[model samples]
Target: MMKIEGTLYPWRFRLVLALLALMVAAIAIRIVDLHVFDHDFLQGQGDARSVRHISIHAHRGLITDRNGEPLAVSTPVTTLWGNPKELQGARAQWAALAKALNQDPKVLTERLEQQAGREFTYLARGLTPEEGQAVLDLKIPGVYGLEEFRRFYPAGEVTAHVIGFTDIDDRGREGVELAFDEWLAGVPGRRQVLKDRRGRLIKDVQVVQNAKAGKALALSIDLRLQYLAHRELRNAITEFGAKAGSLVLLDVKTGEILAMVNQPTYNPNNKRNLEPAAMRNRALIDVFEPGSTMKPLSMSAALETGRWKPEDRVEVAPGTLRIGRYTIRDVSRTEGGVLDLTGILIKSSNVGMSKVAFDIGGESIYSMMQRLGIGQDTGLGFPGERVGNLPNHREWHKAETATLSYGYGLSTTAVQLAHAYATLANDGRSVPLVMTRQDNVPEGAQVISEKVAKTIQGMLQQVVEAPGGVFRAKVPGYHVAGKSGTARKTSVGSKGYKEKSYRSLFAGFGPSSNPRIAMAVVIDEPTNGAYYGGLVSAPVFGKVMAGALRLMNVAPDNLPPPEETKAAVAGESSKPGKGDRT
Candidate 1:
């Protein structure tokens, strides 16, 4: 026993034990140093690999009509994304991934190789929920889908010119979509999410910021009236073989735009081949000489001056009037006879209007037109709204004054014309045009005296009801008051007007006994041998007005009996018309 205890093996065993103890003590010290002094660094390093800040998409708002009918809505969609850092090495599974994503394998390989260093990249955009789910079900590592909102239009092309459309990221691009984009596109959110090295989402850590959904917007349009107007206007434009056209309907009392439609319109939902021309909301954007539609304003100014009465005579005798070298003629009727101001309007006599203009003074004429919302922003807040041109009256020559009085030498949009006519219909109360629904309407300014306004409204009724006037503008059971305007189109990039190319326009209100609606129809370059506003535009007014009056439950002013009128109104309201289009 003494010999074994005294061996060198005993000393070697002791030394190995001491070495092992020292190594354990060193490890303990290092661990204490790391846990105390480098805690933040270690935690940060770990979080850097697993924690990621991600964006949470907020859906857009809903756009509805006055009746709570949806015009625009946000639809949930998925966008497939890939993490190139992980997907770059998953070449073997790429074929399956490509198949699930409905992409070519070769293209997938090229995309992955190109974005090898990127942590995130788009694989497919705007995919259906099922399509994205199928891609994800393949268990392809590094591939994920992001939730997104896409703007969709329920009313399609019929409301396209007004509602507009959105971009791929659900951003409003045109029309109402662009006008109220801030209220339509909501704010996105930020959150920290846990992810593994493969870039798969684990769990949401905490929300850094909350997302806000867009607010709902209600437009002033009545869908029923809107559809009827669209049908009638499209039919008119097509029947006349017009280059383009626009129609605007308004509630005269409230200044609410019930319907505003344009031809050459495109589907906002399907914008694959959208044309810029088709996208124009011509009723508000395009301007032209309003033709004889402006005569009422001139007569109003004349009446306000106390210089002209309804029966006041303007000698359109010889059917022509000469001022300097420029001679104006009444082409419609040249019978040399003294007629009242009402008769002058019925004939659309340029000579009579010119004579009235000189008598009333240009300054007086300009005041009423300006008050009627011409050459002004409509306050509708529509994007790309053009304020029409009104030249300074102080600089008006005799010729210019004459033409201005008869709806020339001044530019105006369909919206402007309709607004002006509505003012007259509402007894000279000028209300701001509203595009959104307003439960409490604003106060209107009296632009003209009630007596003068009513007189003009009465005179306009004669234009529709009078023989050889706008005979086609008459409604079956209502006393219509409107004017037909045939304006020569101004030649493009030239001085003179285009021959055989005319803009047919009809602007007025309905149920002359008590005006409820005011509308304007303008057909540009009607080429099917019917260029007269009475023949082309006035018929559209009759059909649409017939439907609109019934839809609004407006009592017929000239119907036979309640029972007979009910059948007529019902049938007429549902009747369809054809269009003459480009």
Candidate 2:
């Protein structure tokens, strides 16, 4: 068999040749596919192995108050980055980076060593120019820096709540910043970079996307007025040892917020130390029982319905009135024996006012309040505005009706009270309160008859100028009409009012004969002996109103001297049965 195999068959030899040919063709086909079919893909793979990329930041926009005063802005800074693969000795490089960045060497080492294969890592952010120069001088192979921007607030704490603050990435976090983030944060740009053999950026290939700077935002807040209100409120908080306070000034005709200040305001610059209470904008966010200040609304409703006259007499027995389990007592403790509608307002009598509210009925009183914008937001565009709490007429019990009549068992924001009082000054028209100026003035709804509004206005004047009334708030030369409110603050943990803690409030319009500005001042827990609104809050109202009135150049209603007006009031009072209007 071996001897025969020596002379091989022709067919077997042909098969061996065919197998060899197939192997050669397979190798040739692989070579052609690699060189021709995947030419672009191979080229791209090679380029990718040699090049690296990084991101760049764009500049943010400016924030200004209504008067073009800078409130929030951004400044250029440098962010230090490092490439771990390029760092030969991690420990040594981290020490050098720590010294340059003023950070812990251990922390830098951990950050650099944790991601050893990464091409990029942020070492420090928001470095000053000098610090960035120091890092650049080191000429470390792995270390690099990029120019970026960080937020800055020029007005600091003064405009903190209005202008708000931004985050580490220069993005708005609150207030106007959060409200207009899209318009304030500019579009980011992109750059293409080329890397060398050592995995370091050799040059910028090109700018892939051009950055568009953010649009400047102009707010409705007036910086000067903001500063003034801030200073005054801070002073009130300090001088009176008040727990907190707020002052709001409004343009009666335009409904623009001239000034709004809340005490204990925080500085957005040092936001890490901010407290929950300091961040609250009390004027817009807080609501409370308005106390005697709401009495005017009740009386106004009664007069509007033709159910009562200013001179009509109502018997107010003793100083207290028992309704259900609650007893309402007068602050002065004087028995308001026989008081007219005007006398009830002057004395702030709970019994007499309750009579008037009972006559108007719950439905009419609630309807009138709704029309006057009570229990509603004032449309001031402030974030977190409270509409206040007012129970429906059907929900009111016997005691609820009488207590609500004298401004209790209901809550209202300071702005709402000012807006409602403004309606009384604006000839019974309740215009929408606005924070910004509009191209066209918004027409208001008629909440009361003009005659009824005038009667209430006349009665409110007596609340400020009558003999037994708390009228020390009246300015010497200005005809002021407003009501005082001294309400015990409700405790958070208890149903009873806080001891020795009161919220003193005053809402008034200056030059009452032709009102221009309507203002409200609320002092929380004033420690000074004077806890009455007419005594504590009214003085602040007078001061702010005097400045605002003079700023507007409004003519004084009492052109005569201060002494002459007192003499006139005294002379008029000497005549029996002769009533004096404020």
For residues 237-348, could you state the per-residue lDDT of candidate 1 as single tens digits? 7887899999999999889999999998999878889788999999999999999999999999999999789998878778878888878888776465777899988999
Best by TM-score: 1
lDDT of 2: 0.79
TM-score of each: 0.88, 0.84
Model 1: residues >4 Å from true position, as ranges?
Answer: 1-49, 206-210, 334-336, 561-582
Clashing residue pairs, backbone N/CA/C < 3 A, model 2: none
Following a full C-alpha superposition, what root-mean-square deviation does model 1 have from the true structure? 8.4
- Which candidate should be chosen as best, given lDDT against the real structure? 1
What is the lDDT of every predicted structure here? Answer: 0.90, 0.79
Off by over 4 Å in 2: 1-56, 85-90, 115-120, 196-199, 333-336, 393-395, 437-440, 561-582
Model 2, residue 51: distance off in Å is 6.4
